[model samples]
Target: MVLRVNGLFGWVRANDRRSIALFGGLILAINVGAALFLLLPLLAVDPDHAPVTAWGGYARRYVPLVTLAAGAVFALHLMRHVRSVQRLTGFAFVDDADEPRLCRLVEPLAIGMGLPAPYVGVIEARALNAFACGLGRRDAVVVVTRGLIDALDDEELAAVLAHELAHIVNGDIRLLAAADAGLRLVGWLARPPAARRQQVGALLSLPVIMAVLPPLFVFILIAGICGQAAIRGSRLIRLMISSSREFIADACAVEATQNPAALVSALRRIDGRSRLNHLPPGQDAMMIDGASEGGFATHPTIARRIAVIVAVTGSMALNAPKRRDTRSPDQRDRAACAIRTGVFGAAPPASERGTPDLVDPGDARNWLGFTPVMTLGAVLAVAVFLGMHRHDLHRPAALAAALDPRPAGILLAVVGREFVCNAAFSSVGLALRATGLDRPVGCDAAPARDLAAAQTSGSVGRFLAALTEPPAGLSMHPNGTFGSAPSPATEAETVRTRRCFRTKGYARGDGGLHAVDAPPRRDGAFDIGRWLAGAEAQAVQTAAAGPEAGDRPLDDYLSSRKSIVHAVDRYFGEPGLAMMRRSFASPSHQRAIGRLRERLGDPRWAAGLPPVRRAEFTLLANSPEDFVTCSARDRMDRKATVPPT
Candidate 1:
């Protein structure tokens, strides 16, 4: 019962067939009405005075152009959308030989879903989430983060794979794109036309704000933001529909994998840990819904997703086996307990203090193969980057390439190479770095991936807090969210303080220290973004002078020399390491390095890690907050990723 392309396409087309029949009937009705109106006038007046055929000529001439325009747009959507989105958001194919484990797990799930195995891509992020993209089942690609592979147990991973496959089978990829475009059109209709830019200089200046983007790019940016806000009374309803699709996808995952508990566990593990939300506009609609919201949210809370899963499976325990199993309770429990070490290579719970997951040097998913396959992929990506840069030069050529399926697929494969982070690959940068490819003149101030600025912060305060206290061009929300909400005249307004941060002890091997961000014991109220950003930004630069001098965090106060090096480290790792050793690179971090030195002293430090790496570790430690307790505001949030021990 494998899902053949023919069968899948037929079913999808059958289920999603548009109202072309109805449109044809409506067209006949409209013509009939027009003829009756014209003929009735002729009946009242002289036949020669009537203008019955006046409108027919104009309709005949113009209708073809309208149809042609609609066809052209549909062709563009089918041809360009898949690859453009893959490139726009960083995503690369997962090499089966290199990442055998992920490939191994996904194939069975694909079979379970009755579809041809899907192409898998890695997002090269430390965030524990995944999203699917395709024009159809044949072209489908499921993109998982490096974090998702690292954290989830085998069954949980399978559940996720099944969910992504479900999206493909249901034609959700094209449907989502179509729905989003329709919504945008609705928004456009709801608002007046955009005002034209006043001057050429004003138009040219936009790219500077968006990391040296072109004028056309700025237009796309403005449209994405403005369109979402313009929709009227039905806006909330659309969001509800979006949210419902997620539930359906979840159900599909469960039905495919028969492991609702694993999906629940997987959802819990994600918990909005990565700072992907901050990465530019136009991508939010496509990525996983990890942002905070109220009524108009696209995805429900993790709790709600889990509750649905539990209700369907009728299994209350996270570790329980399938509900239909006739096995005795003890045997089922025993099977659950064995989850610590399975195909996914998980370890027992921390309370049990089991041995760590074995790390194989040859494991393709890890950094061991970086010198060969990983480096090769990086080289190919750079070439594709160059090609895409070249491709952007001629509009018609680019459009032609997009319209041609083979060329577009090749472009996506090459573009997708930039996806993995520097960890597993030769490169070390994470997913949030914008390509900034094909930017116009006056390009400068490129965002560095090593800094984690774009990838980590969730709340606006959290994102801003990562920058200098007065973060450049960022807005702060009095409420925990961005937009405002109205209150009744007699209602008592809620008073609140800004949520900030304090520090926890250094977490060794993580290359950073921990912050005790939570308030009431796992109340799930702690904001990861504020904890990381605000707490770090709060740190006084002990090495600086004057009142404002020593206040910047280690990240903001980097010497001009290291700033370029940090920027370079966005793609290259070892050079940043070399730059760190030049001199007091990170004074704030030195304190931690000093702590490590004292703790590991000379003999053990030498034995544990090479002398050369000591400096790199100190420099990799980003940001430093002066431990302070300010007036509490509702804190920002992001990831809850606990690194593998």
Candidate 2:
């Protein structure tokens, strides 16, 4: 048993060094990658530039300067609140004066371990958990939740305190603190751009909107990708710290206390209740029992820890406390209040506690969060500069054109315009429909001769016209005929119906009566309306062309026809109607659409059309099937009778 424990201790020490080295390497790699990304433009412009050549010289003059600056910033930030356990957990430090019993238990354990009597704090949470955190012995603090204190007997509590003291002695606190610092640094780097300053008036300034949006999107995209990488790196560092340290600490606690049974009993008591929800991800390693159990878990399962302890101690039966401490409410409050005031009398003198090397308040806020406007402006300036000097660099003309700021800006503007215009059209149409103002027009009878003439045009042509030409509020009749009607007042509603019709199986040709295909329903139930509609269309087709006209099977024909309905029943029956409504109701979409309309070169494109007509055109233009439905075959077939304006 002694041999095994000694072997484990040696293994843990070596692993700890490797973990630290791995973390240092991760930081170096990240810094190097960032430096390269920032200097890419310079390197691309002239690899032989004097400053670049000198920086890349054998001695590497600039590397140390960059390293020093980064290290200094990191160290300063970490030290600013080194003793912040109380601040983070909202637990006040307790000394012997506050709770002599609790402090007495911890003090003897610290003395036995040959370490300073660290600060002891108690959380008000009901979860049974305890953790030790600090840079080293002098500043170390042990925090236990109220639940843990009330659950365990004196022997069990002493064993738990010994385990935490072992962490301080083993320097595990410093290692965990470094991992936490790395995580915080990554979070600081990846934070989103601050909100833009608002204008005084009700209306927003167009110039400001245009200037902010593209850069905002670019920053988000770039920062999101980089942030993910940093997060993964931090996770890797924690994994490197390994769960072996937990075993080592457990072994040391048993050695110091010489009571393996008490430690095992403490483990049993804390088995399922040691998780602290308020603690962040990387800090789980500091807990006696981590928040989770898996391959990635920072601590071994409670059962495994106990088994190992029993095996090492060669003990079979263990005695543990069954009942919790039954202290009254007044007693608990007195204990809490005593701890809260203990620090005031016991705190070190100002002169003895050296000034913290904290980052400047103004610089910390501005730099860590990132000044979006200024940062974006600088990026744009660099891009513009590179574009202008691309030809002189003797690079490919294509590369220079790609780098040109004008094309990028124009592309973003055009996309933003289209998005905004579509949103506006959808929003206004929905508002009109919701208020019962824009009602759909009733079907008006059209000449049978006109319907025949329209059908005579190529099927492909009819299909294209239905898609490309704006919705004319045309209705399909029961008698296999068409009727012209006034454009619906609720254009979005009508457009949505038409869209649903196409999606269900109605094809553009054959006066929108033929069903090309029927999509399978998720519920696996046959649609009766679709089936009936298919039978009616099939009968009409059979009558027009004799029984043996087409060789297609009857089942296939019926299946296709099953989805083509003449009424708005098909639209209302759709499952995605509510989702569609919510999407159109989105304010961002509306704002984008408005911006798009304002940026268009030709006012007549949208402004000349009535609101309803404008919405119909916008809906058609933005439909996913527009390209395929409005094909050249349909556009060129001009013989089809057009709907009356």
- Candidate 2 positional error at 262, Å: 1.9
Give candidate 1 misplaced runs (Cα > 4 Å): 1-68, 183-238, 286-288, 292-296, 316-645
Could you give me the TM-score of model 2 versus the true structure? 0.44
lDDT per residue for candidate 2 within 95-156, as digits (tens), equals 78876767878988899899988988876665667888878789888987776776667777
Cα-based lDDT at residue 113, candidate 1 = 77
Candidate 1 on 1-645: residue-level lDDT in tens?
A: 232223213333433333233223323332332333333233222233332333554356434543465445546655666665565446667768867878888788787777788888876555556778878877888887666666666777777777777778776777665544434334333221222233333333333322221222333333333333333222343444445556667777777776678778777766655335323322344444544363234466777667656655565325656433233455345434433433222222334322222111111211211223333433444344345456455666643332232222222222222222112233422322344222222122222221233222112213334432323443322111122222211111111111122123222224432233224336533333332233223323323334454213323433322333332223223333243333333444455334433433456543554222333323333321211112111111212244446
- For every model shown, what is its TM-score relative to the native structure? 0.36, 0.44
Winner by TM-score: 2
Error of 1 at 372 (Å): 52
- Once model 2 is optimally superposed onto the true structure by TM-score, how far is the C-alpha of residue 616 displaced, in angstroms? 65
Cα lDDT listed for each candidate: 0.43, 0.52
Query: Which residue window of length 10 is worst by lDDT in model 1?
Result: 488-497
In model 2, what is the error at residue 207, expressed in angstroms? 17
